[model samples]
Target: MSEHQPLSVDGQPQQLNQDEATQLAEELKQQIRNGVIPAGDSDSIERMVAGLGDPRGLMRLTFAESLGVVGKAAVPSLCRALSEHDSVTVRRAAAKTLTLIEDPRALPVLLKALLNDPDPVVQGSAVGAMAAVGAEAIDGLLEVLINPNSTAMQLGLASWGLAFVGARAPEALRNAATSDHAEIRCAAIAALGDQIQSLDDSEARGLVEQGLKDSDRDVRAEAATLLGKLHNPAWAAPLLEPMLNDPEGQVRKNAALSLMKLQATASRPALDVRLSQEDQTDVQAVLKLAINQLDQAG
Candidate 1:
């Protein structure tokens, strides 16, 4: 009986004042907590859907703005609209709203939307939303990564999700570093580095070697960068030749930086070989760092 103004069948305004917006937002919240967040006896969602058709787009934005203002209480209803409503804009807004609220429940559906939603805008919106959902949603995020239907294309989002969850996502990441998809491998490798400041020699050395040889220049470069963050000297040898010899200048540079990270003077000879022999100016930068490191260590 609370005033939400009234749903117009034709094209007229519901005249939603402050009291009305609050009433609508609260009822939507209760129905969601009760798990009855569908159209309900009042068919509230259908009205919102029709509001999406408003010529000015004002009413729709108002609904979205109000739901976002209501915070966690509106999560279930926003999720319901995201899933069941035809308007992708509404769904996108709902995703943004969930980000503000940081609702754990919305994480699964946002994961679904990130991977499965036909709309690209919704896909990116879901990515941002899942990121906001934070650590508790990480298990669901990893499940998406392991699923065959999930993809390397979405690996950036998966990486972000893993970072949000930190160490909790490590097991899945260790497996993904060797995934066939180049982007997934790169993302997984980069994600592991972000999650862990240092990897044991066994954990990183072989992966570093394999990744240094990755077919994609960007992947190889990222692997080299991640290896740089590892403090172990064993990675120095594996990373040495790549610093001066890799086809990509950035990869070689990162390898040089990583070798220095190991604080090894032994890297000098290999770097001198690259500087004297390699053509890229960027690679020369790496060669100079090696000489500098050698001087310091001596």
Candidate 2:
């Protein structure tokens, strides 16, 4: 019998196969889960990192998720994969695993990927990972947003990550709101909406109010949505009047929806007039809904 002969299973020679390899991989992953990752186990860490580039998508994802289970010991290998891996899939999975690990040490690598990665998917995953890191990642993410070479989508992702950081992110967001770039400004304005509850009343109101008058229609629409969330009836007329006359149908719809939230009876007359001239079917429906809401409140 050859020394390399297949193992016997119930007295029959069983050939080593793909199924066996997969089972072995799974068992190793479980062992890592049970805290078998001894210090200085560079070989095991390398094997797990290599598994992240597996041909099978499920296997790749499993390895990525398992990195978190491997804990801090996996960070160095994962970071190397994130920065040096030739495969975008491997790099993307590494970014995701770092996020799952939530180690602050990964911030620099994630920020680099968010700003300069050729692949948008990798950049997007990096953004999500940055958000997962929360307040600690804000300064680095803000640097990306302000960098001249950053793409529009990159700035947008940076804004979203800052927004996810919420109240902890006001200073960076405030500066970004005034950026020379319109997309960055719009993203910043929209992000402020997420920080409303944490902001002082005047600060929150001032930021949203500024956004309401912004030249960008998207900014104005976002302001209207945030105003509704504020639910401060004092500003209902400010929202109801100018916005009802705004050129953008979406802005007009948002204004009407905000009025509905405030139950501003004062807006009923203007809304009625705007309803007559409103061209978009969707805006007209929202206008009618706002009118009904006001009537019910009265």
Candidate 3:
């Protein structure tokens, strides 16, 4: 049990034949339970875990077969192996096992799994583990949000997870407006939708202007809603063009409301044609608002 004792990772213990895989597994387990795992043993343990097939092995519903036999002392080595090992299976097993150990450090290390690991399964597990972290983890989570390559689901979830981490994603939101992921774009649009609705006119104007021509039509729709709610008078007319031509009903409706709120009297020519094109419940709302705005302005 020396702090630096090396494991017989080549399966050299007299108790285990090199070809008898079961014996090697048992020996590794016994060593860990006995606190014989030494510092810097990550390389050998990573190799051994890689040799054990998937942590998800043949078992369908649970990690009953592969990870069940590993012991607590193996936890640190497994965590270390996640970053050091070239093998994806090794990284997956380490990220999954951290959930069992409940290590505070595990939460931070798992963030690396989402950002860098070769395996998608491990990356998915890393996202699930975000609830477990200190205040510092908020910055790391925002970093994930800013990464365009992070999966759309990850970006969407990261936006929602911000409440748990409690950090504002100012730059992340702006960058995400141009994101290639539709879900990320949608989530970013909603995020700005709420912000614009609450913000003062000048502050909200910048957001509305930047979001106007977003590639995603849904985002443009939400952006229109924000411009109107914030009463940014300048954005009112430009938002109307999208309402007239945008295929989506919601986007059209959002633009009409913004135009109406801003008393866009000069924008009436653009609005009349778009009103004819819009027929859904969303557009009807826009029509009612437009009529009211016209009456008030006259």
Candidate 4:
């Protein structure tokens, strides 16, 4: 078949025979491996891959992998496909390709797709791509997290992305911790705790303390859980101890669990007091467990 002639398989376009498609893919891979796409030649390669007529999506995946092999050189065309392509399959393939390339230039289009893509798979791919860009993607991810228009799922994905964006992310997290928007603040605090290993004790403590005092019960509960993950004895008294008295049962339970994780012997007295007055059976059980853990440690 002529390279330009569109072949049909099950009524879907199949531009090249299997052998021809494979040969073209291999050639692109070799060129990519060699770090040369002959300058301005990437557009041609992208066009060829985008034209592949595989109905089952296997050929599209194969070609997308080849685009990934092409690396930064393929970014411009891939970004185009991600933003301008009419086919969701092609757009999704482009997003995957950009993720493999991990070029920061793809950030704008990737962020756009993450927020607006009608396809969940495409939005997820954009999230993965943002993560693949690492530190460079932090600002854009933060923008998404802070946007009131962002969906709960988008905020969750952006928060997850921030956790993977390296040490620079904490600065954004710090800002988000105090956002007027409760969801942003909650997500930021949760992300801050997730990266506690990368933070200094003071930074972690300050952020978690802020969360524990938040008016929102969800933020307080998340903070209590984060403190447990940190396992810092320093937080047991000023932080976890007071949380045992929080009106929110979930917060009290999390605080007790955190105290247990820290093995805070000092919290034993407070745990005893909480257990005597705790109305929720679950919170009381956790308080008893905290007391038991402290006893064992002592």
Error of 4 at 289 (Å): 4.6
Misplaced by over 4 Å in model 3 are 1-75, 134-136, 148-154, 157-298
| Local accuracy by lDDT, each model | 0.63, 0.74, 0.56, 0.74
Global fold similarity of model 4 (TM-score)? 0.76
User: Which pairs clash in model 2?
Assistant: none
lDDT of 3 by residue, 1-298 (tens): 0122232223221111234444555555566667665223444444454543333353211221234344444555555656565666656666666555444455556667777776767776665555434343445566677676887666655666543332243454555555676555555555564444444324434655656667777667767776676555664576565555667777777777777777878777677776665667667667767866876796
Q: Which of candidates 1 and 2 is the stronger one according to TM-score?
A: 2
Q: Alpha carbon lDDT of residue 192, candidate 2?
A: 78
Tell me the lDDT of model 3 at 230: 52
Clashing pairs in 4: 13-53
> Of models 1 and 4, which has the larger lDDT?
4
Clashes of 4: 1
Best by TM-score: 4
Better of 1 and 2 by lDDT: 2
- Candidate 1 lDDT by residue in tens digits, 116-232: 877877776777777665556555565666667766656556767665554554555667677776756776667766444543435645665677788988788887777666665
* Clashes by residue pair, model 1: none
**lDDT of candidate model 1 versus the reference:** 0.63
Residue 31 in candidate 2 has what lDDT?
71
